[model samples]
Target: MCATHKAFFSYVWRKFLNMYRFSVISSFLALSCFLSLASYELPDHSNGEPTTDYSINEYWLSLFSGFSKDVDVFYVYPTSWYKLDPAEPDFCAIDHPTMLSRSKVVFDIQATAFETVGNLYAPYYRQADAAYTLSLPADKRWAVVDSIPAKDVIAAFDYYIKHYNKGKPYILVGHSQGAQVLMLLLKNYMPEHTGTYARMVCAYVIGYPVTAEFMSSNKHLKFAESAEDTGVIVSYNTQSPSVAPGANIVLGDEIGLVINPINWKRDETPATAEESLGSYMPIDAQGNPALIPHFADARINMAKGVIECSSVNETDMFNLSGKMGPEVYHSFDIPFYYYNLRENAQVRVNRFLAK
Candidate 1:
């Protein structure tokens, strides 16, 4: 899995750095450990207000500041079913209550994977897990949380709309399990909030799918069909034609929803595309990078179109299975994924804000 993620990284490094220096540096054990340091500290969000409790670590916020625009992006990360001991300093412990925080006016919900005890990473379970977190706070802790109820998700969104959302235009972003939650958010909330959707620049959902059902339901919610600017949905997923043994297999949401970041289209072929990094590269009509965004291309299809995890979509069968888990290979993959998704985000969001 690490190697697979690294391949995606190679593509990204090729696109931006001009040389694979980062990859070379990344190979060094000590340097890699230092890079692994949390890019951002979870903001201190002990407060109870929905908007106030959401905060981005300084490192993350610093990175976000590089954006050409001031559009606010709310990020929801996956969580494990670990308990938070307010007694502990890592207030951002894996639990319900500890997940809530007051960092910005935006609302950031943390997906709770901490409490559920099972061989997770299954298809339907991921959907259910993501749905559960979409409505919870960054710090709200729960005991023995239920893991199979989609209805809970609907109710949670209702509560969020009444409380947190209250009618504000916002950008949505997520990865992996969190991405699953974002998918449901678009289907259940975004479309219905067309007024808000219009106000929303776009959704940056990576490592997940934006299925046909979702695309067909909302005329406004289209995938990034081209490298050119787009609105509403900017989605993609990474897949390796063959992952190493013992890799983590993520199942949920069909492959249709899982798109190739490079093309922003359905996953169909392993096109041999090359990325160049140099002084003069083509820029999009919108002034964004015209070259393929780094790390945007993936080897697997994440947005397969299956509503139920157990459904008959062959894409659902695809997994990162093997001896080691996804964690081993995620570092390389995550940056590239973020690089591509953010590049598209920069374009679509600027356009959305301009409108």
Candidate 2:
């Protein structure tokens, strides 16, 4: 090789090696930080473990004040066994949950898959010009009320019913543990308050199951299968039929209720309505830009290729390039599945209101 070319190749080789080293280090720091955050010690609620009551209450209050449309939406977030009580004045003082073993972590990995997918439905409760709020309850606290099935969520909803919701239409959204609780509420609590059902604009219960038994036993339970803009159920799960993760599995029974995260309709193909998000006018399944919800749709432009590339085997997906710090990464990467779902949801919710 010529001397100049050899020097250039040497430099490129060195750069690649440095980049590789940086990737390894960054991933470690990022994972460590997430562990630190996820493992924070929770407070001792009256029953023992921490409670998500505070987060749920705050979210409801925020959503109530944030929107001017005069509608009510009940939102819930699932709990992780590793959840720490954010309400505790001194969250760092308590020790981490050492009782949780590696297997528990794997279980949580699968459980949180649903949690992450479920909570993404929050922005769907409002119109293009309005705002929606989300409140999440902490999970896995020792307090009887702090666990996923704890009383905080129900109590919060009851509080809203007693104080705010009278005749206005509403939406119900939840994920994982929250979805489980919401399913129960729909089956038990909402029925007693039949008026609540009449007002339900829609319910997006992701990452939780509404079993065939539940559907069969209760004539009232049904999944939304249209884009007509009415009250409906939207749910779905992510999987390649051949590459199943084997444990903490979400089976056919559980997966049956999941709707396509793309278009809200049950029968439509799970392809993006607009192939290139960064365009002037985007169209839906009908190929009409007039029907698109712009604000929510902006995400498609920003995250067009994230989901398929989410599983970066290295510690960090983005290189530090010599920057010294922990680099954290969230799931639902580029072409964020959640953002597309959020946009699709807004479009559907708006249609429901227009009618």
Candidate 3:
């Protein structure tokens, strides 16, 4: 071959190799960018410090102005934190933006049930992830799950009592993990502080189990006998009639007292769907506030310690992801009996006042 032809071919080969190398480098950089965008990380707290503020104005969801009611609803919200860096922290930080946003939606759907009957006071505490209780065996999970979150709840309650409660009668309301924290609060706080127990209207601990052992041990706390019963607990776990009880949410053999919010009865009486006044759905078709009315019938199954509902309008609000079956209606516990609970709160409040 000619020398000129050999030189030209060599130049072409080198250019081709350079272009291929450039393409490979560009593709590698693009893939890295995509992975970074896809990866999930817990929101970074300022200076990596968890918030410690529990002042009524800062944490309370509803701080009524120029209005007073005979009863105050001290509510604890359910599992709103989904992300955790198993290495970084077990309990979610209170001021984390994601936790704050999620807790607001919970307050609207669950806490609003008591708005008409009393002044609502919901505190934002460090709540364990939904899987916190389910990830480990019953014995191990309860201790770890309650450790950090329980302290914040106790502190918040103390703050509420000293500043906001002002000798007013109060109702303890909690759902799912919130209920678990409140159970600890009731057992530890109320028994020692008899004044707080005397002013208590009732405790509505929904979604989580309140075992017979716990109640029997805590003599000051009484389970509700009827709708108008004062200073008692109104608790129940809801599921479809087909779903059996024995889920992790209700630990142990001794299932505690359950009152049917629909019928306001302790027995296995079926309350028709017509009896449910309304359920406050946080979002509408367009993602707006929509308070929907009467979509479920409830009947207590004394054998299982859960309320069996006939129907549920399964929306994003009711959608919960867990090991629990369809029968484990944890999300719909409050909404299913929204109005019934509101009216029952008034009944108990009035009865407490009368006495």
Candidate 4:
């Protein structure tokens, strides 16, 4: 297994600080711990209505949702609920300041890759805390997944359809826990709503699993066989071959559906560092991102069902998988191939519109 969600001071600060440097993002982590605690202390976060209701504008974090783009992007942020208390509820409130701050930073970094290709709309959802979910065995974690986060996200998606979509084609984007939520939505929601499914450009389910078993059972869902494939799912977890040896956090028992962000191929063929279009990395201590060329080389680990990029540095990804055993590059999945994803999204959107 990969590293436990280790409780280290430098780990959280260094990981988040190094990742963003608070450059383009606001002061993300400085108040996160305190703010999360404050959110827990609040007596009434829901205000009579179920806070999960997306009809209320407070539940959305719209970045480019109204941008004049032809396509729309409906994004769900990853697990930002880091107030690690076992006594705390399994899911954090939508108003948890830490989760909201973290969600903003991640939306800027991860979802913005699609901004050039579509108008972006991210919803605030009640996601599980990292430590609580990570503590459970992999198979059992879905119990948490099937509960709050799933409900909030699907409700938000339903809201997006009835209110904002206006018949525009849209792309589904989510990472880590956010990606897991999208998986649930795709499996349970999309099937019944064929009209909405038809308008879906594709899903960028990064840093999570879209396992073979998942695809086999849902005959309507398909994994990305190429960069330009529309109405398909694009997913892969990032890992290093040298790091941990046991089962990873995201890919449970089955083989995950993967595509090389560098080359868009699922097979184990290596995509050299030179083939990369440069990664978004912090240029200095301040965390301003720069397009650093040749940041990583990607190749699929078929047995492990992950994209192994040995070229990545532990400091860059904040060594998120440090406690597990080896490297699980969960944090760097999107940034490592930042430019590639930005371009690939446009490619798929363009292809879909042309048809």
Candidate 5:
């Protein structure tokens, strides 16, 4: 071979090897980056440390800072940790970043409804991950769900009552799994402590199911019949008119309570959309009420025991559809009736005080 041809071939071979090495390194680095993002886990709260100390300010999302109100509200937030790894930690530590971010959204959208009517107090409890209940079998799920989360709620409520409540009439508000915890608290805690139960202005247990069997068994608690009814429980799960009773989050065999927040009625009578005060969506970066959408009408399905909204704008961010159907508005139970809930809370508080 000629010396010039050999030199040129040698140079070409070297360039090809360099490119091959660069491509291999780049591919490995890209895979590492993707794995790091996907495997991101929440902080481990499994150290057997005491998760809450109400004496410290960090344990509370909102504490009494000398603000005065006729009544107090003790709120429990819904499922905020959706991506929590079952192997890493089942319960979210109070300072978990994702939990805090999601909880803020819940407060902004749901807890704000009661701000005008009372002194709001939301505690940072060790909430169970969203997967805890959904992943387990029906018989096994409740046992796991009610374990850690319920203890945190009960402890928080006890602390709130001892230090903050000061014998003031208070309202209990909880959504989704939070509602389930409160229901357990009502059944297990209230009976032993009659005075505390008596002091409860009302309980707004929204988004979760409250079965007829459970209500019938708990004689001390009464489902709210009218807007002004105090010392009662107001509960409902919102769905589209087309969604059937057994579909979605609501089980077919279960008979749960329902109330139309717009009209504040327990019966199936339709409340017009014009009657709806407003439905507030999530806040933007500026922390303002993002959007307020209105529906045409709302009514309780007597047989299904779920609120059936009419002429719902599916395009709205809050009016979401799921595998169950277009009627699955579980996340927007509070936002969908924001104004009506706020006003109804005040009305009930006034009636309670009058008596």
Candidate 6:
């Protein structure tokens, strides 16, 4: 918990203890507890350490805001910020001119999967620069991710639950850097927000690994064993068979639980390219944004704990790569099974609501 939130709740408790009549205090306390559970507004962003104003209209590049549905999708975009100069700050500000535009493009491409199932809420956070963040070892990478970037997302989420959610079920989705931070968000923030957690149909933490340590620590965390399992995480890192075992997104020594995007199974059973509904390929140096029907196949590489795409050529996939080797399909994790994800979300939500 942030110190500011602690202080706010403490202030509420102090006031709760001081009321004169026991019954009056009891009634008011119940209201206060309800209000607390409902939403928590963060303190003003005046402290100026890359403080993100979630209340401001510009900070959020939301695609589907006001909703007609009972569910919502909170999307965090992958690493678009690439800081080459060592002297510059390690994070991308919420208002970085090009970053905002890139976020919109990325969202339209990535977040659209859930648009049919729920309203989209994609926030502009001061996220870690891809180059700077990836250069570091795992521990340092996490430190950078846990700093200002973490705060922006947590605060944005709190604002979301505070102002928008109103008890509606929601799904969390992210790719690459966004996926890593979402993992941290689930670990650090969700424990205190169990009510909100319970309403999650599933978290599509795509293009990242969900460690067994994480599952053990957050006992509430569950890897989706089936397509229709509500309140579980659906995740898989995509790489071709040639990417080499350890070259994928699997964390060192930590077990990453993976589910095949096509079959939604945890085992090594191969789901063929023919079963793949389609892939919404992002416009790369090669081509324009286009949907290729039955683009890639998914089969779990159990030894490395990642989805190994075979049957179709990995080089044929459209994406812009930087430091990551050509074989790693980190960019295509969602796009590879865009239709499947969209369909599975509806299936899960339907199952959740049915129960």
Candidate lDDT scores, in order, read: 0.36, 0.38, 0.69, 0.74, 0.71, 0.71
Off by over 4 Å in 5: 1-51, 84-86, 137-139, 250-253, 282-287, 290-293, 315-325
What's the best-to-worst order under TM-score? 4, 6, 5, 3, 2, 1
Error of 4 at 75 (Å): 1.0
For residues 268-338, write the lDDT of model 3, one tens digit per residue.
97888777786654332223334456666889888887788866533322223123444456666886678
Stretch of 10 with least lDDT, candidate 5 = 21-30
The residue ranges of model 4 lying beyond 4 angstroms of the native Cα positions read 1-51, 63-67, 244-247, 315-320
Candidate 6, lDDT over the whole model: 0.71
What would the per-residue lDDT of candidate 6 be over residues 1-355, giving only the tens digit for each residue?
2456335434442343232111111122222222232133322322457558788877888945453788999998876555444456656667887577666666766899889999889888886655444444566667777778778888898889998888899999988778887888898888898898889999999876787777888886888999999998888887778876555432434457899888988899999988988877533332235566766888997888888887644433312221255566665677678989999999999999998
Structural similarity to truth (TM-score) of each candidate: 0.46, 0.50, 0.79, 0.84, 0.81, 0.82
State the lDDT at 69 in candidate 6: 89
Against the true structure, what is every candidate's RMSD? 14.1, 13.7, 17.1, 7.4, 15.4, 17.9
The deviation in Å at residue 92 for candidate 5 is 1.9
Error of 3 at 50 (Å): 10
Q: Which prediction has more favorable lDDT, 2 or 5?
A: 5
Once fitted onto the true fold, the runs of candidate 3 whose alpha carbons sit more than 4 angstroms away are 1-51, 84-88, 247-254, 313-323
Task: List pairs with backbone clashes in candidate 6.
Answer: none
What's the C-alpha lDDT at position 80 in model 1? 26
Worst 10 residues of 2 by lDDT: 125-134
Q: For residues 1-355, what per-residue lDDT tens digits would candidate 5 score against the true structure?
A: 2456335434543443333221101122222222332233333333365537777778788786676897999998887664323355556677888677767767877898898989999888777654434434444445555677777788889999998889999999999778988998998899999999999989999977788888899998899888888899999888787776566543435667888898877788898777777767433323345434453367898888888776554434222234324567776678778888998999999999999
lDDT of 1 by residue, 278-348 (tens): 11121222212322333223343333331111111122112111112222222122343333444555556
lDDT of 4 by residue, 32-105 (tens): 33333422322322234353778778788884534378899998887765644445665677898877787777
Q: Model 2, range 1-355, lDDT digits (tens) per residue?
A: 3456435434543454343332112222223223344344543423453433433432331234433454455665433223123332222111123212221222222222223222211211100000000111123211222232434456566656666666666667665445556766676676687776766777766544455566676667667665445556665433322222221122211334444444433443434434322211112222222222121111111111111122221232224312222221211111224445445555555676677
lDDT score of residue 305 within candidate 3: 78
